[model samples]
Target: MNLGYILVVDDEPEIRRLVQEILEDEHYKVAVADGAEPARALYQKQRPDLVLLDIWMPGTDGISLLKEWSSGGRPEVPVIMMSGHGTVETAVEATRLGAYDFIEKPLSMGKLLVTVERALAAERMRRENVRLKRAAEPDTFLIGKSALMQRLREDVERIALSESWVLIVGEPGTGRAGAARYVHYHSARSDRPLVEVSLGAVPPPNVAVKLFGAEQGEAITPGSFEQADDGTLVLNDVVELAAATQLQLLHAFQERRFMRVGGREPVPLDARIIAISDLSLPDAVAEGRFREDLYYRLNVVPLRLPPLRDHREDVPELLNLYVDWLVDNERLAYRRFTTGAVNALRHHPWPGNIRELKNVVQRLLILNRGDEITEAEVEQALGGRPRAVDSAPQTLFNLPLREARDLFEKAYLEHHLGRTGGNVAEVARLSEMERTHLYRKLKNLGINPKAVKEP
Candidate 1:
């Protein structure tokens, strides 16, 4: 069982042979190179986990080769510099050039083995950190038990069995990205990298370079496509891409390969593409905002996520999920929702969808110090009255004129106060009422301005 792939570069045949044998004995797959050119070729081809580089090579000494490798940035693979004629200056230069560690020749077998192990471990940690940073999110999978949610899960599972590209469509905060992740995690290529990039977040000028990578002479930068080679690439808000970029992407899909920004060689498109968009691709095409050809290519396996309002029955379950998730992950105070609070939330119109619900749950847990979340606290957190009160105007007709008028006034004033963050003056201005009159009215209606203010 090979531990890791390692490349050994040394001008001295004896040194190369000895190092290769030692690494191979330690269950590592070893590749040897005699000089700088062969070493460069091998490094580019193999992309070893670690490089054991000899400093005093024949042509283009190890320092120069290291500089070439590090020119683009720190090389992805760790390189340990080996030198027969050791010097403090040489070691510093190598370290500065991004070598993992400096190792003097007349190599101690024990130290060499330990250093190799440490370098590989460090590289693994570094890659894991990068992966975590890129993939960080509140939840990797959807949380709901409603019929709509169950159907969505089933669809995602079925889609994961295929190698076809997926286009996930949903309104904002509908967990389109989460759906994409679920598909990837359940797919055959789950063991490989799952790279996600928001096309909307990237600038138009750099979209090509970001997606297809850039190659300037010896310096090569692998973009999202290459980084996700064997796994999945989730392109968020893909409809936000520019016209030119959309065409370029369409060409890549059509040809099944793409060239780097500056290079002529076409790299194979091996990763499964999972595109996400708040807007429907068909609608975007109808509006001439998105290319029709690109839409067709990506929409091969279309998956539309239902908005939270459509799955209102799942509100309680989702609330509990987020509450527990926030408490466990964010170390936030745990607070159980009362039946009234849960019922109120189930009837609320979630215009911002699941994202808004999670935010509301988080806000309620953080701001309210009570052991249980009540209906009033839920309403306050949502910045509005319960849906029954706000959505039902017919019920007001049953009351006498005076009572109905007062009820209308209180509801209207409270809405304004909520909108203005309890700014009485702003509410008065908007209502075209004098500050003094509005204050008296609010007092008469028992609507406290300070109480209405959002936390």
Candidate 2:
């Protein structure tokens, strides 16, 4: 992401100068206006990234001006409403008029910068989403380019050709369900409906009634396996099944025949069952929570999905794929991550994995609008501080101010570089840090901005 060109429109000369200096000091290009009328004029002419409109401006106030701006169809640009003597009504009005967020008077520098950065990140994600929507087919398989992802795709392809039950394991947000869909979609019975049932939702008493049918005469509610005859049945979160249900499921798999509900009539099972779990079912079986026989039955062709951190190499590629498909052929600014943003993203633990990354990108596009996001913005949005490679050690949070600052700084820098495609100048601007200072720190810390370069 690049630095934003901000329009600081205020009546007070001090306020105007202060904002202009602050934005410029942060490496942002500034377009200043002394009043709302002038602000409107400059906004129309230059089309800056964001607007900082004062609530107490002379003539048309912030609320009225916000309304005017929104009606002007420039609502896509994020407008942050600021007020020194603002009432609740005034703030609400500003929001109603399409302001991204409200900033009260005497704002903290960090808070202001973070708000701006978040707004821009959000906008970027939004545009990316639109692009992705336009480019990919509805069922594109393994569009990602990471090594871990390639392995996953190969497994999916291999398993899709077989009737053997597959057990997929991974952390939450690791795309287990998505992978299951791929296997089913490519399988022999691809034309038939894929019946999905969540094992976690089945209680003990209803377990038998769900997997195998009771009987023809019995009033069975019809389990997914029965409904998926000649197709695929997906048992999601199967790890949550109790030992008793596991045993029942195991028997059904071996016999390939079961009665529905209370009916005594036996029906040959025609569906191919594919079960997935976020937890290691083998471990669960050892704990006596899962049935060993069922675990082995489902593990006939087990597949392990890769965690996001292990495949950090694919982050940018996947991001780019999604972006290209989302924004409709780069009509958007098509801003990439700065070096600092990308590095931060790379260093991130990604506890929530790919899903988390997707959500972060979405948030960035909606929040940031037109401007490129910075390290500081990434930190604030992610609740992690930016850090330099050679910075002093500090806990995530600390009792002292210095310690907290250090942690935040590191997190900020990493996220900025990761998200902005590793552009250093853009990162410094978004972070509101002097270019000279940023360069010196990067050099001293031995941080190579190019390390986050796009693949």
Candidate 3:
């Protein structure tokens, strides 16, 4: 692999050529600039990892150029100053101007190589530090120890090694975006940036400009695709994209390049695209609400995230994880759930999935004062609407026909009874059944009429 990109800025042709040859031999990609103007242009195009600058030049002397770069909006790269008649004052000035090191000409090849290596290493360390400071929370990775979660991790690992575009499908609040980031974090391009764009969040008028960028006069704004080059671009709620933006994205996917809003030349797309949706793309396509071709393009490698209710065994771990996260990140009081509370949560139907669970955990930790959370607290936290049965739709499929019928009938009766405020006559009218028979069915299903009553 190439070590890093190094730009050699010097007026002397011999010095530029010599330094380029030396760095290239060391497996570093080298870009040579004859003067400050060209160096500025090159830096704007591709920010190099390190710079070797000649302090004395014909125009725009190295000191002046260095002063220009010291201002805001300068590229973040290590610059080493080189001068044949070096002065102590000049060295001090360069040092004050953010130069990494000052080296006298009649350059020692060994010293040059060592200095270059050190500068690059230092730059890498500085960047890594900034990245860590701004990095997403460590809790972004899925939290669970259930078999379903274990298998999901395996699938993510296997798929992350590939280069294909991915489509993540799941229900709302199921952490689909987190799964996409997980794939990106584990992929070969993990070191590169992961840029996310939520299509549904962008206003319709600004959608195109946000996705494809816009150019007005001399100003050019790079969009998500260009910003994520050599990295991963996450399109959240991709199914909610406007029709016009959908067409633009489809073309970009087909061509692997896109022109800015007011530009002629196309910018190459080197980023891996990962699209996410909480809705069914296939159904949207069939219903003519979404473009079929775009759907097919994004559905290259579909990964479905199981809802939290489907993996209830993981609730305790998730509860603890979120509680600890809240305590540490939000500075909430440390709290632990009682065993009964954990059991109750494990049996409760989490309609909002992991996202909802996280919110509930944070709310409980912040709103309640007790160090130990009890089952009654969880019930109040859920607004007393948590499903007691904790049954998943797929679980019914595995049951015998008679058992499945009974389960469905029980749930169905409970829903209508609750909707009707436990008025047997109203439920009977809604179910089209005699009130007496409905009473017998309610008793048979073991549903307490009093429990469904409104206050």
TM of each candidate vs. truth = 0.73, 0.52, 0.71
Query: What is the per-residue lDDT of model 3 for residues 75-168, given as tens digits with 9 covering 90 to 100?
Result: 2568899999889999998888899999999988789999999998886677566556545455433678988888888888888999889999
Expressed as tens digits, the lDDT of each residue in 350-395 for candidate 2 is 5455665665555565566445766655665565543232222323
Q: Which structure is stronger by TM-score: 2 or 3?
A: 3
Evaluate all candidate structures by whole-model CA lDDT and list the values in order.
0.78, 0.67, 0.77
Clashes of each: 0, 77, 0
Global CA lDDT computed for model 2: 0.67
| Top lDDT hit | 1
Runs with alpha carbons beyond 4 Å of true place in candidate 2: 1-144, 213-220, 325-335, 386-455
Name the 10 consecutive residues with the lowest summed lDDT in model 1: 387-396
Q: What is the lDDT of residue 243 in candidate 2?
A: 68
Models ranked on lDDT: 1, 3, 2
lDDT (10s digit) by residue, model 1, range 1-455 = 97888999898888888888888988999999999878866754435778998889777898988888786577667999998898999988888889999988699989999999999888777756765654565552366787777887788889999999999987655777778877886789775668899887788999999999888876677788877766799999787789999988999999988888997578788789999875445556877989888888888999988767677888887887788778888999988899999998998755456766776787788889879989988887655675423522423454434335555676677778878899999998999999987876775455678866442
- Comparing 2 and 3 by lDDT, which wins? 3
Q: Tell me the deviation in Å of residue 378 in model 2.
A: 2.1
Q: For model 1, what is the C-alpha lDDT against the true structure?
A: 0.78
